[model samples]
Every structure is written in C-alpha cells, then in structure tokens.
Target: MTKILLETLKGNPSDRVPFWFMRQAGRYLPEYREIRQNAPSFMDFCYNPDQATEVTLQPIRRYGMDGAILFADILVVPDGLGQKVWFEAGHGPKLTPVNTEETYAELSLNGFHDKVGNVYETVSRLSKELPEEVTLIGFAGAPWTVATYVIEGAGSKDHAAVRQMGYGNPELFGKILDLLVDATSEYLCAQIDAGANVVQIFDSWSAAIPEPYFHKWIIEPTREIVARVRAKHNETPIIGFPRLSGAMLETYVLETKVDGVSLDTGVPLDWARDSVQRHVCVQGNMDPHLVVSGGDAMVNEATRILDTLKGGSHIFNLGHGFVPQTPPENVALLSETIKNFRR
Candidate 1:
C-alpha cells in the first residue's frame, strides 16, 4: 500500500493532502491520560514498549491520521549520553546542567545504544502494529535545542546562559553541539534500522539562536546529521522542523538537504509556498489556538491553509503540539476538513 505521508515527503502529489498533529498522542486524549497514569514515571512510560506502542497507536485509532510519531521524548538523547534527566509532575523536564568542559567530557556515547534500546523496540512494535498506509515517524531534538536543556538544566524563559556561552565560549559550546550531532545521528539511524519509515529532527529553540550563530549552530549540525543518516539509510525520508527560523528557513532546507520542511505558525503562507514548498514538501503552520476555538473558525483557518498550499506537496498539521485543554471534537472536525479538501 502507498503511504501518503511518505509519498508527500518525496514531493509526490497524493489524491488528497495528508495530515497529522505534532503531539497527536498526549494528555489531550482521555485514553492517553488513563494509560499515562499507569506508568511509574514519564520516562518509564516512554521506555516501556508496551505502553509506548499503545499510546502511539491511540491517535491513529481515533483519527486515522496519516502519520504516527513514536511516543518518546527528546531528552532520551541526554539520558543516553550518560547525563541525569527526569520529569517533575507540574514542572517539565529537569536535567543536571552541563556547563564546563569537564562535565561535557563526562558525557559518553559508549552506552548510548544500550540506554535507548527500548525506544528502538517501541519503533519496531509500532511498525508491526500500525496500518501500513499510516507512516511511522521517529524523531530527536536538534543539537542546539537539546544543548539548551543540557546547559540550562531545564526549560528557560530567555535561554540567556546558552546564548552567552555560544558567543563567549564558542569552543566549549561547539564541543557540546558536536557530541549531540554524533549521538543524534546514531540514534536516528538506529530508529530506521528498527522500523521507522521516516524521521524528523525537531529544533524547537532555533529562533533563540542569534543570526550570527545560525550557520554554525542550526545549519551545520543539521546538515551533518542528515548526511550521516542518509549515508546509512539512503532511501528513508527525513523532515527538518527548524521552528521559527524566519529567513533562515530557506537556508536550512538547502543546506540540510531534508526531504521535507515543517513550517511553524509564524511562517507566512505565500513566502512558504514560493520559497520553501517550491523546493521541498511543506508540512505545517496551523495555529493551535484555532483548534481550541473550534467551529467555523477552525474550519475556516484549515481551509485557508489547504487552499494556500494545495498546488504543491503538503502535509496539513498544527504549527506546534496540542495543549491539554484542546477539545477532542475539534480534532475530529479538523481531520474531517483535511480529508475532504480538494485542490
């Protein structure tokens, strides 16, 4: 069977636009919440292949989405690198900060594969469980974004410390990024070897990097990961989501050589169509707030996105992950709209 999502990523037009949301499997769904409660910890939930595989299939079972991303977190890379990573109930991820060259050197890739082996098992199980028509996407955080958590030890309001280090201590910061690049590339290649039909590298904090550092931090590492993965799995499709990269989006697409580019909410439709979509398959930009405000508002905005990118290879999706408050019915309506869209 032809997987519409993979075909679209290859710049091939499907009969209808393919669609999937960022956090398709999470707290928004009551089913996911019920399952989440069973796990002792969030990291445990991700590491358990049985629970992880079920959560991954939940969204697909409910919405029949074109793609099913693996149910895992980006911090798995840090944990695999031998750093301490954990999640707080109300607060988000908390990691033991790595600042000086000493702590950085302490991170070792010796047991990286052993640490994330369960994730690969989850991917393997998902491939067998999901309908062949639905694509299985595996992903990891880009070096810069993952570096932020490593340097700051948690999510930050301004990412000041990391930025200061990138500017002030380029050698130290560059070492962290280089290590991430090697580790991320290996992790992704392993996912493909296990069964992921496609992979995405999420650079959630790309916008925080100063323009001068964009080339070294954002573009270079991504290009290296892409090159490394392609060297191993030459036929597998790779999508790059450098969220809020602005003018650098074009440069990211050209330099990284990703098969597709995901556009965030801030990207303009016309600019994305003319510059980004024209070059590779385009995958997002819907505002998550509209999903919450459902009714004609949601339908109207989704329709406008479909109309804007209808002429090219496109995958309809939210610019970011869904918030916990999103009504499930609205997701149904949004999926209905995309399924019925015509050029």
Candidate 2:
C-alpha cells in the first residue's frame, strides 16, 4: 500500500490527514525511556541498529502514526566526519569545538560511512520492519544548524560562538558550511539508498540567522543539499523544517524546491495554507505544549489547525515535538484526534 504520508507529500490529501509528530519516539513515551536507560550514551544508542530500530518503531506501534522518523541525531553527520561528540546526562549533546579552518580541515568524509554505517543499518531495518502503510522518514541537520553545534561544541541559547566565527571570519565560516553541505548530502543519500522512503532536513537553528544573510547561510546550503539528494533519489520526497523561519519559509520552499515544508509553531496557519501549502505539502504548526496539557482546549486548537489547512495538502503534526513531561495518554488522545479529523 502507498503510505498516506507519502501520498500527502505528493500533494494528494486523503480521507483523514496523515499524521505524525516530530520527536514522536522520545522521552514522553515510557517505552523509549526504558530503552534509553539501557544505553550508555545518546549517540551510542543512535549508532546501535537494534536499539534504534526498536525506538523508531515504538511510537508507530503505540500511536499508529502514519510516519516513522529515523531515531538518530542531526549531530551524527559531524560525528561521522570524525568530530568528537558526546551526550551529557541532563545538558544534551556536546561536541569538541571546530572553530578554526584547521579544525574544519581535520574533519574529513573519509571512512564516514564506516563510522556511522549502523544508522543506515537502522534505516534498512526500519524499511522492512515498519507497517506497509507507514512512511519511513530519514533525516539530517541543515548545514547552518549543524554548524552552530560544531562551532559552539554544544547547544546554545544565543549561538554567540557561531556568530563570532561567521562574522569575524566569513571565509572560514563558508568553509564549515560547505563541508557540512557535502557531508550532509552524502549522509542523507546513504539513508535513502538504505531504504528510506523520504527525508527531512532539520534546520533547527535557522531563526538565529539575520535576514540579510538568510539566503547566503540558509537557502544556499539547503538548495544544494536538496539538489544533491534529488540528483541521487529523484522520487524521494524531501521535507525542509527551518524551524521558526517565519515569512522566509515561503522563500525557503521556493528556492530549496523541497517536496514538503514542516512549519514551526510561530507560522500562521492561514499564511501557510495560502503561501506554503500551495507550493508544497505542509506538515505542522500545532503547539506541542497543548498535547502535553491535553483536554478540550488541546482538541479545539487541533481542530482549528485541521479546519484551517483542510483545503490544501496537509499532514497533522505538532509545531515542534512533544516534551518529556507530556503524558503518554495525552499523546494517544492527540493521535486519535488527528485520526478522527475529516473534511
């Protein structure tokens, strides 16, 4: 059976809007937390095919979401390129800072597949293991977002370290972005070859960029990655999630030529339906916190999202992702609400 999400991405809406949430298989799900405890580190868990595949399937098994995103980190691209990466217990991902052209030069694509081949193995397993109707989504970080972590050596509130590098020395910054573009292209293509049905590039830090250089830093690398991936897998749908890019999203959609665009919470649904959905399939914009505090209010807002985007190609999903504090029952409720939504 052709997956509902895939069909939706092709601009064909079905009886019920195909639904999935970002970070669906995450800490909010107890099953995931149980599995996570057994693994020593986040990256280690991602590199382990068996564990990764199981976690990827967990949300699908529980909520019957139409999509199953690969369970891996965006930083995997850098880690594959030989940068030192580790996850702290509470703080999140940490990488050895790559601040210099020298450090960037040291990172090579040589033996990259050999290092993170297990992620592909996980994708390979998921392709065969997922329900026939479910779409298997493979993904990576966009160059700018991944570069932020590479320069900062961890998640940042302001990305000051990255700005210092980008502004003080754009030549060096360009090199980092270029390298990321090449590496990310290769990484995502490998995932598709390994049996992924689609891919999503997560530009989580895109909003950090100023408007003047948006095209230089955001659109250019993404367009290249989209082109690179399409060159290899012409039919594979690519979804670009430049979270919180606001009005620039229309520009991103047009220039990047992605098959779909995942809207962040801040994007107005009416604007997205008019500007974005007309161009490509749109997959989100619901505030995830609503689901966490599930009730009549959550269902009402979800209904509003449904009613708003009903006219064009739409996939029901959270604006971002579910938080760890979210109740699993709430997730189930939200899933059922999406499943039940109809025109």
Candidate 3:
C-alpha cells in the first residue's frame, strides 16, 4: 500500500493531506484507560511490549490515522540509562538529580539496549501489524529536552536549574549533553532496525531556552543525532519538533537538516508557508485546546489550517499532544474534517 504520510514527510503534500496527532492514543480514549488498569505503573506500561503495542495501535484502529506514533515516554531514555526514574501520581515524573559530571557518568550504555529492548520489540510488532498504508513513527526526547529532566530531576516551570547548571559548570553540563547524543543515536538506530518507518525527535522544552544559547543547546546536539541516525539508516526520514522556537525555527530547519519540522501553536500560518515550507515538510501549528472544544469550533480551525497549508507540503496535526480532559468525539470530528479536505 502507498503511504501518504511517508510521502508528506519526504516533502510531498498530496491532495489527500495525510495526518496523525501527537499523543494520539493516550488518556482521552476510554479503551486506553481499560488497558492502563492492567499495568502497575506508567513506566511499567511503557516497558511491556504487549501493552505498549496495544496502546500505540488503539488510535489507528479507532480513527484510521495515517501515522501511528510509538506508545512510550521521553523519560524512558534516562530510566534505561540507570538513572533513578519514576512517575509520581498527580505530580508527574521524578528522578535522581544529575548535577555534577560524577553523577552523570554513572549513566552507562553497558546494558542500556537490554533495559530498553521492550521499546524495540514494540516497534517490531507494530511494523508487522499496522495497516500497510499507515506509517510507523518511532521517537525519543531530544538530548537537550531529556537533559533538562536529568538536571532538574523532573519537569520544571522554567528549567531554571538546568540553565543555572549550564552557566555555573559548563564542563559538567557539556558532558551530560555529549553522553545523551551518543546514547540517543543508538536508541533511534535500534528502533529503525526494529522496523520503524520514520522517527521524530521531540525537543519539547526547546521553547524554554533563551535565544543566545539556543544554538549551543538545541541545534548542536540535534544536528549530531540527525547525522548519526542517517549514517545507519540513510533513507529514513526524521522530523524535528522544536516547540515555540519562534523566528529561530527557520534557522533550526536549515541547520539540523531534518526532513520535516513540527510547528508549535505559536507559529504563524502564512509565515511558515512562505518561509519554512519552501525548504522542508511542515507538520503542524493547531492548538490542542480547540479539539477539546469540539463541534464547529474545532472544525473551523482544522479547516483553516488545511486550506492555508494546502498550497505546500503539509501534514495535519496539533501544535502539541492531547490533554487528558479532551473529549474523544472531538478527535473523531477532527478526523472527519481531514478526510473531507481537498486542495
């Protein structure tokens, strides 16, 4: 079967307008809740190949999404590396703070693949089981984004701790990023070997970095990872999501050499079309909250994005992942809108 999503990711926008949302099969779906009950903890759920494959396929089965993202968390990288990691109820992911290079060095690749092998297995299963027309997307948190969790020990409002650490001990902080670059490259390559058709690098916290250091912190590591992944899987397309990177996004696209880039809710539609789309495939910019609203409110925004970006190589998607409170019916409506679009 021809993969429309794959074609779009390679910078070819079909009249069909291929699409898949971030966090497509998570808390919003009732079926996912049923499966979640069977796992002891969130990280445990991610590690179980059977459960992970099921949740990843749930959205594809429900909505016939053109793409199916692997069901896992970004923190899994640190957990696999031997860092103390866990998800606390209500509060979110907790970890042993990695401040000094000494604590950071304790993270090793000795049995790293062994620990995270379930993720590769999940990819292997999804590859064979998904509809031939659907694209299998594998992903990891970008080095800078994952390092934020490592340094701060959890999600932070401003990522002040990691920034302070970078300023105070540039050598120690540089060491953490360098290690993640090598490890993350191996992780993504192993996923491709397992049968991922395409992979995405999620720099979810890139927005938190100031302009002066964005190149050193975000672009540099991501560029290295892209080069490493391409060395092993030359044909696999990579999408970069530098959320809220603002005007800097154009520079990132040129520097990182990604096949595609996911836009955050803040990027302007016409600007992205005129500036970025000419160079690479553009994947998003819609607000996730509109889907929670549902009805005409959701349809109108989805329609606007479809109409505006129809001129270029575009893949319909949210600016970010879904929130738990989102109504499933809204996703259904959004799917309907995409299927009916023509440009």
Candidate 4:
C-alpha cells in the first residue's frame, strides 16, 4: 500500500486520513526553542545539519505526524543567491534588496549548494530516520514569495513596493524572477537528490495580485518551476501551497501541474471537493485558530471537511503553521479528533 500521504496524492483514498501541518516544525514547540539556543543564529541553526535535523524530527516524535517537513527557512534561497539574509529575534527575515542590475549582479549562483548544504543533510538524515509509514515532505518558497523578501528586504503589509517595481520596470523585475526560477529549481532538484520524498512549493503571497498580474507573476513562474522539477524527478509528488488563491486555485492546479494543491482556511470544502480535488489531491483547509480554540468549533470544522471530501483523495492538515502561542494540548486534541473521524 502507498504511504497514506503520498497515496492520497496519487488519487487513492487512505485507510484513515493522513495528517500533517504547515510549518509543522517551528517555534510552537518548546523543544524547538530549546534547541535553537544551541546554535549561534537562526541561519546557523538551519545550516547546522545536527541541529536542523533534530528540530525536523522533534514534531514527528511528539505528534507522530503522517509527514515530517524539513526544518529550514524559505529565505535560504536568498542567502544562496548572494544576498545577505538574517533574522532579528522579534523581526523576521531581512535581506539585501536587489532593485537594479548592479545590485542583482552581486548575486552569484556559484557554490549555491555549498551555501545551503545543511538543508540537504537534514533531508538525508530524515529519510533514513523517519518511520516508513510517515512520508518526508521537502519544500521551498516559490519565486514570487521569496522574491518579495529579496526585493523588499523583509516582510511587507501590502507588498506595494515590490509590485510597484514589477509594474514600473518589467525588464529588471523579469530578470530577478528568472534568476529565482533557475536557482529555486536547482535547489529543489538537489533536495530531491538528497532524499526528499515529496517537495512542496509555498507561494504564500499569490493572492495579493489581481488576475492579470497573478498570471504573470504567480501562475506562470510556478508553472515553469513545476515543469522543470518534473523533468528530473517524476516519482516525487510536488504539492503547491498558494496560500490565498481562492477563486483561482483550480486554474493554478491545472496550469502548474502540481500533484496536489493545499487549501487555505478560506476555501470552502464543498467547492474544493467538487472543483480542486477532481484535478489533484487536496491537502489542508483546517483553521489553525480553531485548533487553538480546541472545542466544538475545532471538532465540527474538522468533521465537516472530512465528510465533504470523504470519497476523494485528501490529507488532513492545518490551513497554516501552528502558531507559537497555541497550547500543545490543543494540537493533541485536534490531532485525535481528526484520527477519530470516518466516513
């Protein structure tokens, strides 16, 4: 039998629903925080195979999740592309913004693998260590999302700055997108070589653009990356997480050709079962906040999604990462609630 997570992605129903969470390995768990102290910086922790590998395995040991996603930041590509990338304890990722060709010239693909080698080591370790039943998902931020940080230097409220640069100077913006496409494709292909069973591309910022801009920046670039990855690794499943691409989700699934599409909390279950799942396996749509609330709302939402998508191929997962303030027991309760549900 196929591992539940992969089998579901292959258009087969599982004996029980397979479960995993976005940002499954991160600040929410104390063990992850405890281990973070042992490394010099966030990037150090991500680059240190031992430390990264430990954090990657922490959730699997605690929650017995159906899949263990690698522990590494999506901004690692920026660091690989020769931009200085870092995290401020309270602030989030910062990078050297590439606004011009002169600035873009500073980024070199030379030794890109050497720069992010620890990520590969983390994948290699998890593959050998994870239980056979639990699949290991490897991932990277999509070009548009990662490029937002590279162009804006940090997270933004409206992403107005980058979108302006994209609109104002299409050529320069196109160059950066092209670089990211080449670099991200190489990076993900390398992760597969290192031992990632499934690779997910996180296009978290796709929803911000209007339809025309969406096709140019989000859909086309993602389609290219997926096609490139498939050329070399046909067996590995690629799940696309276009965080808030609600109405256009079906278009992305068909055009990008990803093996699965991760639904955010805003997507309706009935719409997903009738539309998105007919094309590719669907994963996620649970409200992480509801899981945090952990009462009747949590159980009801979980049951509704499962019931709606029952006969179709689906995986149970949170709409986004488990937040740091979430009570651990809530996660446990939600996990159990999902396991107990059946058609």
Candidate 5:
C-alpha cells in the first residue's frame, strides 16, 4: 500500500499530499454526534473503546483522510492521575487543581493504564480495521499543555493562571511536568504497542509562555518525552504541534526532536519551508474558519498552501479542527481538493 503519511514523514515524495487535521474526529461531523449520543458522557465515550473507535473511524470513513487519530481528550492523563476532570457542555474541560507538592505527591501513577485502558483498545481496533494504506495516529496533550488545564481547571484564552503558577512555584510545576513526562511517554508507548503507527504530542498552549519559561516548561519536557518514546518506539513517528509559538517554531522542532511539526494558521509558509522543512515533516497552517466560509476563497488559500510547500515534506490539514458550524459539504470539498491535487 499507500502508507503516504509515513512515507511523507520520512521525507520521501508521495503520490499526493497526505492529509489529516487536528481534531479531525471531533464534533464537526454528524456521525460523531450520533456516536456521542451513545456515550454516557464525554469521558464515558473516551473510556469506552468501542465508542472511541467508532468516533476515530468516523471521519476517516467520511473523508478518506490519510491518517486516523484516536478520539480521546488530553485531560484523560490528569483524570487518570486522581485529579477530578470534567467537561461542562459549552465550557471545555476542567480539572481540580494540583497546586502544591503535597497534592502532587498524593497523585499516583499506579493503575493509570487500567484507568485509561480503553484508549489502547481503541488503538487495537483501528489497527485491525483501517486499510493498510492509511496511517493510525495516537496522541496526548504534552506535559506543559496538559498542565495548563490541570492547573487552570479549564480552557482559557490567556492561560495566565498556569503561567503565573509556573513562575511563582517552579519546583511544584517541575514535579508535575516530570510526572507527565513519565506518564505521557508510557501512554504513547502503550499506544504504539497497541498498533498506533504514529504519535503526535499536542502542545496547544506553548505559544503563551515567555521565552525562558517556554524552553523550561514546553521545550524541555517535550524533548524528554520524545527521547524516551524514541528509545523504544524508534520507528513510530512523533508530530509536535506547538500551537501559536510563531518565532520559536524552528527552535522547538530542532531541540525537541520530534519527527514532524504542525503549524497553526498564522505561521508564515516561507518561514516553514525554509526553517522547518529542514528539521522535520511539517503539517498544517490553513485557517479552519475559512473552511466554514468555503468557496473560491477557501480553494485559493488551500492551493496556495500546497503550492508553497509542495516540494517539501508536508501534510494537508486545517490549522486546527473544524468548528461545529462547519457544513459537511465543506469538509467533502476540502478532502476532494487535497486528494485530487496534481502535485
């Protein structure tokens, strides 16, 4: 087979640009909605291998993406560690904060796998069901990214709470990062064993931190995870998506040792081609909002991304996941454009 994603990650030319998006298997699709109905709750669906596998495969079946990512949230790591994590209808995820060394010490890694076992089951199912040509991707939010939710208790536009906590009490913060490095590495390795062909670490909040803190919290912890995972699962490619870390993108890719780096919407293409492609496979940089407003505008922007990055290792994808308001037809058109592109 086709295995275009894997080939492209290795810097080989593919028959077409291998494509998949961040949150590709999320709320944008109707099948995902139907599957979500069967899930007891958001966490229930994630912890249920069968439902998780169904959601994971939903977008792949509908769009024929080059990759199929597991449908589980990043906060599952915190939940597994004895922190109380929940999702309110409109408010994204929330976790009971672990602010002190004593509290962090109280959390245990024992039975962590058992708690999140369905994730491995979902990976196993996808391995057997997916066509040999399509790559199966498994992922988790990186340590620093997960920490933001754990400390702040939910999504925030500024991430001020976590940053201040990191600045005020780095010792405790460092301990949490350490625990995450160990936990996330083991979690991803388990996914590889369960048959995930690739693993991507989502450092969604990396850009929010200042330079020094960014290196200490975001870059360092991520590098440790990459090195640990690569020690055992060397062949399993890792993609690092440090969302919004514009100027620091090249440095993050070089220092973190990830096999691929995913760019957010605002990252300039020329910078990506010259700086990033030299270090690792690059995926993304298209605005998801444009997909919501599809037509010639979306088509032109998509073509421009492809034309600029055509000669290098690239994966066609939206800068982020599609929004709930996105029309199903828009997704179909975007998929068709990528699959049918001549280059």
Candidate 6:
C-alpha cells in the first residue's frame, strides 16, 4: 500500500492531505505518561526499544495519524558523542557544557552507533510493527540547534553565549558543526537502514540565529547533512523544519535541497503557498494552542489552514509540538477535521 505521508513527501499528488504532529507521541496522552512512569529516567525510557515502540504507537492507536515519528530525543546525538546528558525532574534536558575548543575536541564519534543502538533497534521494530500505511519518521536535532545545547549546556532565552561564539569564534564553531555533520549523517543513515521511510532535521533554535549568520550556521550545516544522507539513501525523503525562519525559508529550501519543508506558525499561509509549497511539499503552520482550546475555535483555525494550503502538496500538522495540557479530545477533533476536509 502506498503511504500517503511518503507520497506527499515525494511531492506526489494524494487523494487528501496527510497529518501528524511534531511531538505526537508524548506527554499529552495518559497512556504515554503511564509508560513513562515505568522507566526510571527519560534517557532510560528512550533506550528501551519495547517501551519506546509502545509509546511510538500509542498516538497512532488513538488518533490513526498518517505518520508515526520515532519516540526519541535530539540530545541523543550529544550523548552519543560522549557528553554528559541528563534530565532533571521539573527542568528539561541538562548537559555538561562544552564551551571551549578543548571540550569540543573531547566529542568523538567512535562509539556513536553503540550508544544509540537502541534507537536504531526501536526503528527496526517500529518498521515491522507500524501499519503498512503509516509512514515511520526518524529525526535528529540540526547541528546548530544541537550545538547550542552542547555549548550553552541547556536551553537559553537569547542564545547569547552561543551566538557570541559563532561570531567571535567562527573557526571553532565551524569545527563543532563539522563534527555534528559527520555524526548526524551516520546517525540518520542508521535510521534509514533500520527502515525509516522519511527523516526530518529539526532546527528548533533557527529563530534565535542572527540573520547574517543564517546561511553559515543554519543553511550550510544542514546542506552538508542532507547531501551526505542523500548520497547513501537517494530514495528516502528528507524534511527540513527550520522553525521561525521567516523570509529565509525560500533560501533554506533552495540551498539545502530538502524534499519537504515544515513551516512554523509564524509563516504566513499565502507566503508559504506561493514561496514554499510551489517548490516542495509543505507540512504545518497551525497554532498548537488551538488544539488546547478545542471546539469551534480549533475547527475554524484548522479549516483555514486546510483551505489556505489546499492548492498544493501539504501535510496537516501543528506549528510545533502538542503541549502537555492539550486535551486528548481536541486531538481527536483535529484529526476528524483533517480527515473530513476537502479541497
């Protein structure tokens, strides 16, 4: 059976738009919370293929989404590189900072595959277990975004330190990005080998990048990874989500040569249709908050998104991940709305 998500990613005409959220298999679902409780730590949870597989399929079981993104975290790359990565109870991910050239040199790709072997196993199992029609997506943090965590140690409000490093220490920062490019290419290829039909590079911090460095930091590293992945798996589709890229979206799509581009909520609908969808498949731009509100408000916003992008290849999705407070019923309603929408 032809998977609609894969077909859409290939820019092929489909009977209807395929839909899936960024963090679809996550905290909002009670079932996921139950499974999460079983594991001692978040990293432990991710390392368990059985539990990971179960969580990955939970959202699909509930919503019948067209795609099932692998249940994994982007920090796995830094962890695989031998960084000390941990998650605190209320706080998110915490890492031992790699702020200098010496620390940067400490990151090695020697045991990368061994460190993340479980994730590949999860992909291998998911490929066999998922419904034939559901596209299995594998993803990793884009180098620049991942580097920020490595350099700054955790999420930051302004990304001041990393931005300053990018400007003042271009050479060192370039080395860090190069290391990620090599490691990330290997990691993504392993996912494809494990049967991922599509892969997405998530540059969640692209919005924080200064305009002058967009190409150097955002475009170049991504282009390198895409080129390397395509060299080996020419047929597997790649999606680039440079969130909050604004007018630079056109440049990103053209230079990186991604098969699809995921738009954040800030991207204007008409601009996306004319500037982006005209070039490649477009996924997203719906405000995730609407799902939290639900009812006619949710329906109206979703309807508008569907109506706006109806003219081209599109995937129904939130501008970002679903938050923990999002009502499960709202997800069901959104799914129903998309399944029922017609051009």
Task: List lDDT for all candidates, in order.
Answer: 0.94, 0.91, 0.92, 0.87, 0.87, 0.93
Q: Candidate 2's error at 263, in angstroms?
A: 1.0
Best by lDDT: 1
Q: Tens-digit lDDT track for model 4 on 1-343?
A: 2578877777767668899988777777899889987788989888998888888888888888888899898999989878999899789888878888899989889989989887998899988988888888899999999889989999998888889989999998898988899999999999999988899999988876888888899889998999899999988899999999879899989989999989998998888999989888999889888877888888888888888888788899888888887777778877888788776
lDDT of 3 by residue, 1-343 (tens): 8899998887666789999999998999999999999899999999999999999999998899999999999888888889999989989999999997679878988899999999999999999999999999999999999999999998998999899888888899998999899889999999999999999999998885777689999999999999999998999999999998898999999999999999999999999999999989999878999999888888899999999989888989999999999998888889989999999
The candidate 2 region of ten consecutive residues with least summed lDDT is: 205-214
Report RMSD for candidate 5: 1.1
**Residue-level lDDT tens digits of model 2 in 1-343:** 8798999898777888999999999998888989999998888899999999999999898989999999999999999999999998789899999997778888999999999899999999999999999999999999999999999999998888888888889999999999899999999999999999999999998885787788998999999999999999999999999998877999999999999999899899888988888999998878989888899989999999999999888888888988889999988888899999897
TM-score of each: 0.99, 0.98, 0.98, 0.97, 0.97, 0.98
RMSD of each: 0.8, 0.9, 0.9, 1.2, 1.1, 0.9
Instruction: Flag regions of model 4 displaced more than 4 Å.
Output: none
Cα RMSD for predicted model 3: 0.9
For residues 117-208, what per-residue lDDT tens digits would candidate 6 score against the true structure? 99999999999999999999999999999999999998887888899888889898888889999999999999999999999999998985
The Cα error of candidate 2 at residue 216, in Å, is 0.6
State the lDDT at 255 in candidate 6.
Answer: 94
Residue-level lDDT for 91 in candidate 3: 94
How many clashing pairs in candidate 1?
A: 0
Residue 249 lDDT (model 6):
91
Candidate 1 or 6, higher lDDT? 1
Model 2, runs deviating above 4 Å: none
